[model samples]
Target: MRRLYGHDAVDIEVATDTQRSRVADVLLTHPITQRRVAFEVQYAQLSVAEWRDRHESYVQQGIIDVWLWGHTRIRRARSEYALEPYRLDDVQDELRKAGMRVTFINPESSQLAIAVNRFGRTYSLASEREVDLVAFELESIRLSDQGVRSDAIDPFVTAAREREAALRERELEAQEHAEARAAIEAARAKKASARDLERARAAREQFASMPARVDARSGVVRPSVTMPARVLCRQCGKPLDATLAEFGVHLGPCRWEQERLL
Candidate 1:
């Protein structure tokens, strides 16, 4: 793996004391991007928590960590042997949570195998699929910005910058759309409030124009009504009573208008 990665301008077995005191089993550094990748070769039995802790520490230091399980052939069924670690499912679960894939290097064939799906426990052999190592290096380079040379920009850096710009533009556009929707909603609410106020004012005006009336037999006051007379009360054409100042210009009390105002 080191020899293959070397051709792609990646340095292996690099030492780092920032996260841990120990030397990494395999470290791949991109020359142009200065992206760092630490490959952990897990041969012995290690707990899932410990694995995650180490991986997280590397992540905090802005390093991409790849776990490489030792070549241990464990029988899953009668004839098939699962090429994974002791606690394959648990380790793979942790890897899946971190959005990473488990790697295995076949000692005999010197071939690389990657676990594509942890749930399905499926692996694809690199040699069989003709996976390009150079392409993989470029991908890793795009992940890290540490130690990147600013003197000259590579194709990968340009592409990464373009992707970031596009992502920012999309987020800005979404925010603008949300603000526009809120503004439209506010405008509609304002219009609705204005319409309600206009309706209420029109109802008050119509009620004020109506004339008061009274029952002849009971002598009780009745609701106002429209009438033809101009000088007298418009309701029943009745003359305004001087004693009933509360009735305004009408002959009877305007009880409904007073109740509505309250």
Candidate 2:
């Protein structure tokens, strides 16, 4: 298994000294990230307490440990099953707690088989079902050269960061476009205001030029009647300011004119 999957990335029978004691087993290490995996082989009978102690020691050191067992079986009902019992009082409880499972090596087929406990629901007097022992054949166990079981998560993280950057760039561009549009709108409003002021001034100038008239009964010149001023450009409908030197300039020559002659 080590030659086919682990290759040069992993070292066999590596000795690691922890706070409790030294552990010698198959040490799988990722070539790039240097993550470690420990495999422990147990052929002799061990108490449940002792197994838990050894498993917890490696776990405390942040190392993943896989327990391999040979010729270990737990009986359930009338048949003896190779898998660990589902009962809470059994040693299988300790194995499940340690996140480990017992694997059996078949000498005849030269293959690895894992014991699995399954439960079925049936319409009967018993609401709870019986435990069915099943053996699953492990066709292959391939580990990456990088020590990663499958693919690395770094690429997914990198892609997410790139997408976030692109979203921010789009937001910034939208903000710039909005600001430019607002500036254009402000310029238009200012120009329109200036044009209105010019038209009012032109109307006032026209009103001041009217001649005075006399009252027939008082025999006196009547006060000059003031009329509302109108100061529109003759060539165009646009308003103009009487104070400007080019107030009488044709619309075609005006700076504010939009159309041009060919």
lDDT assessment of candidate 1: 0.52
**TM-score: which candidate is best?**
1
**Per-residue lDDT tens digits of candidate 2, residues 1-262?**
4554458766667765644284646777656666667767655667888877877777777677765554344334442553334322244456744434434444446444343342232111111122233333334544443222212223332443455577799999999999999999999999999999998888666556643332223333423335333344544534455553245434356544535432
Candidate 1 wrongly placed segments (more than 4 Å): 1-23, 27-37, 42-50, 59-64, 68-172, 217-262
Which segments of candidate 2 are over 4 A away from where they belong?
A: 4-6, 18-20, 72-89, 121-139, 143-262
Model 2 quality (TM-score): 0.41
257 Cα displacement, candidate 1 (Å)? 34
lDDT of 1 by residue, 96-115 (tens): 45545445555555544443
Backbone clashes in model 2, listed as residue pairs: 198-240, 198-241
The number of the candidate with the highest lDDT is: 1
